[model samples]
Target: MKTVILIGAQGHMGQAAMTGLKKHNVITASRSGTGCDHTVDITSKASIKALFEKVGPFDAVVNTVGYCEYANFSEMTDEQWDTTIQSKMVGQINLVNVGLNYINNGGSFTLISGILNVKPIPMAIADATTSGAIDTFVQCVAHELPRQIRINVVNPTVLEEAWDVYGEMMPGFQPVPGALVGKAFERSVDGFITGKVIFVDA
Candidate 1:
């Protein structure tokens, strides 16, 4: 079976991917080291390099971590902006940069984004910006990556269960189940497409 790494292994999406990707050799990683075989600090190049060194070789890498700040562009704090840049954009980008040396040829990389990338919302500039960045990165890298390795991003609408917390902000959006989002991740990791943003719409 092909080997895959599920970053942020303890999150809901990560857990769901664990189930969906059970057929592969799945290795889980979390910053806090929860529900994972390894602990990875994606922001640190040394941490990522050490992780792949220990795991030997993987066929794919699925990143399910990263969060963005919510505030008006003017009111957004430097801390919030910096956090999103470091955690959401730069961190994942760094993963792709460093992970190039570890995964096997023809392997794939899967990333997560939300509907906010396309659907604009107040105070969601950070999220939407980062999500769009991810998609762009995947598209550009797909054409440049050596060895046929592919990359894709999944952009899901508001999840059904997450409605309880965010329904007011995302009006009119039909919610989707977490399992469906999981399936999208599975497709990105195992499918043949590259540089595509698979929408998991409701």
Candidate 2:
């Protein structure tokens, strides 16, 4: 089985992904390092670099977390925008930027992006924009990556498990099972396709 590093391992989505990746050797990570194999702050390149260095070697990487702020466009503060960009956009990108040095050849990267970019909701401009950016980034980077390294983004709608918390915000949108979303990550990690956005909406 491939050795895979799964970020945000404590979150609901991360737990969901773990189900599908059960066959692999999964290394867990989170910002707090609580119950995780290592700690990482995706916003900092140094932190990401250090995690990879500490882990030694891995065959795949799956990122299941990013923070985004919700606010009306008119009321959105500069700090809010900066936080979203740093954590959701630049932070995830940095994983790929820094991970290249340590990841095993032919290994894959699976990133998380939400469905907000395509079906947006009020007060989610920043979140939607970052999700779109990540999708586009993955598509563009797929062509440039060396050593057969592949990349894909999973664009899932609100998860059924998270619906109790996020349901109100989604309104008419349907929530998908976390298991289905996890399978999308499985596809990216185990399949040959790259630069694809696997949507998990039900």
State the C-alpha lDDT per candidate: 0.86, 0.94
Using Cα atoms with residue i matched to residue i, what is each candidate's TM-score against the true structure?
A: 0.94, 0.99
Best of the candidates, TM-score: 2
List clashing residue pairs in candidate 2.
none
* Overall local distance difference test of candidate 2: 0.94
Best by lDDT: 2
Model 2 off-target regions past 4 Å? none
Tens-digit lDDT string for candidate 1 (51-152):
989889899999988878999999999999888878788888888899998889999989887789798989999999989898888888889888999999
Tens digits of per-residue lDDT, candidate 2, 1-202, equal 9999999998989987887798999999999999999999999999999999999899999999999999999999999999999999999999999999999999999999999999989999999999999999999999999999999999999988999999998899999888888899899999999999999887
- Which stretches of candidate 1 lie above 4 Å from their native place? none
